[model samples]
Target: MTMMDALGLIENRSYLSSIVAADTALKAANVTLIDLEIIRGGYVTVKLIGDVGAVKAAVEAAKDAAESFGALISAHVIPRMHEETAKLIEKQKGRPAASPEGAKPTAKQEKEETGEQAKTEAVQEESPSPAATERNEENGQEKLTREQLEKLTVVKLRQLVRERKAMESATQINTAKKAELIHSLLEKMEKKE
Candidate 1:
């Protein structure tokens, strides 16, 4: 290969290839006619533009003072390239500085957050509990479904019984009595197991 092939690389502006050539020559000291970059003004220039070590070795080789035995022969060196630079940036919009600083959240804070999450979940149009839809005030009555009745917990049943017993309104006792009987049956079943 002639010096023209090496010079042709400059036309394409291949910065990477020059670094590769420098690394190859520096490491293995591979010397060939193709490795020499013949300049226009009669001096053969070998270019090594990379890290500091690469530039040093390339300069020595180009000056024929490399002392690399016959393995590194002929050329002048020009250093012009540098390695790629690296940078990193981070951005946070909502993160707190220390998150209350090594204190770890209290149990109450955890419970409150859980309770808030539950309230949000409940508000998302999930299946309603009977307590969720209280009796219509104007009518004073609501038709509770069997499924709702079946799903009531013992505490809920006790609360309902207490509410029924405390009713000052005279007209609702018959329905309340029926509810009490069902509640008694539920209590018995719960106790039996």
Candidate 2:
């Protein structure tokens, strides 16, 4: 085997439950990993290959493995095939997006392409999107996104729950295919307060 073949990834998972969840998640994606190394510090890096779908799933599964184990795991999505930006560009058809209608190609012409692909071309021009923050700021009355709920430093989650004057539903989460996001938010409040 070449030197490239010898390098491997290491990961550590949290608990038995997480391990099961992580393993199941990985297996569903058809990634073949040896030396699952489920110990607190064991890691199994599956070499990256296969179609975009399978590779992406394997990477995600490995990440879930770390999250499940509650391990300080670091998984890097190395662009084994080529430079990352190039790989991303390849995701888009090779030719650059056509310029907007009647727009002349000037120094600003390249910058004017506000379509999705242009934004990906260079990261320097990007601005932080406010959609998520705006969604989180609605009088604290609007439903919280998973991330917003996650960020509330426990105490804040409690205050928000008490402030929730209306109850949405209970049976929605427990006996359903999905967990109650709102209920989880309320739980945060109760746990903190």
Candidate 3:
């Protein structure tokens, strides 16, 4: 696998711990910061991409730093991530950060600041709401088809599973593959029927 093919992930219970982890990871190796996502319940996840050895080293360092705060949840290194998984990470990078204090710029705001309002409008038109993508009217009942489930991103599928409380832990949802997420959601849907 190429140097850029590997992916590293580190999740922590607090934003401060995650920031420290990200900082340590960057200083420890030549990895690129993919994104730092602040999930629900104040949990934070830092993603990195680089050579297999570099990513592994970075994650190890990050894990140690995050653990010092007693906030470390999990850390993993994918030596060669699948193309689809890489695409999902890229898609997530395009999304606006959830903070409302203008700490992070939204895509539209970034475009507008750069005098690209037209492009921003185009992006808004192209991206549909999560609800629209996940559900459809089936005999007047709101249901997600298997095809739709497959079309949904892994992150979205994990959110669906979490919302249903089907999984007992966030780590399970985070570590599950796309197919596993789909299967779990499908099983939950069936149980609801």
Model 2 regions more than 4 Å off: 1-10, 13-22, 37-49, 81-193
Model 1, C-alpha of 134: deviation from truth (Å): 8.9
TM-score: model 3 vs. ground truth:
0.50
Compared with the true structure, the alpha-carbon lDDT of candidate 3 equals: 0.81
For model 3, how does the per-residue alpha-carbon lDDT over 1-193 read when each residue is reduced to its tens digit?
A: 2324699999999999999999999999999998999999989999999989999999999999999999999999988877567767766886433332446776765774576667676656543446764443433334566787776667777887897766889899999999988888778777666
Top model number, lDDT? 3
- In angstroms, the error of model 2 at 66 is 3.0
Report the Cα RMSD per candidate: 27.3, 16.2, 16.5
| Residue pairs with clashing backbones, model 1 | 62-75
Q: TM-score for every candidate vs. truth?
A: 0.22, 0.27, 0.50
List lDDT for all candidates, in order. 0.40, 0.44, 0.81
Superposed model 1: Cα runs more than 4 Å off: 1-98, 101-139, 166-193
Off by over 4 Å in 3: 1-4, 95-117, 120-193
Cα lDDT of model 2 by residue, 20-122, tens digit: 5446545756543333344434443333333445546666666665665576356544333444433333334344433335867655435545654565654
Tens digit of lDDT per residue, candidate 1, span 1-193?
1111111111111223333444445564333322335445333334433444444554444333333322233444323321111100000112122232376866755776788889887655333455755554554534344455555544454455455443333344334555654455445434433
Task: Give the clashing pairs for model 2.
Answer: 11-43, 13-69, 14-69, 14-70, 158-189
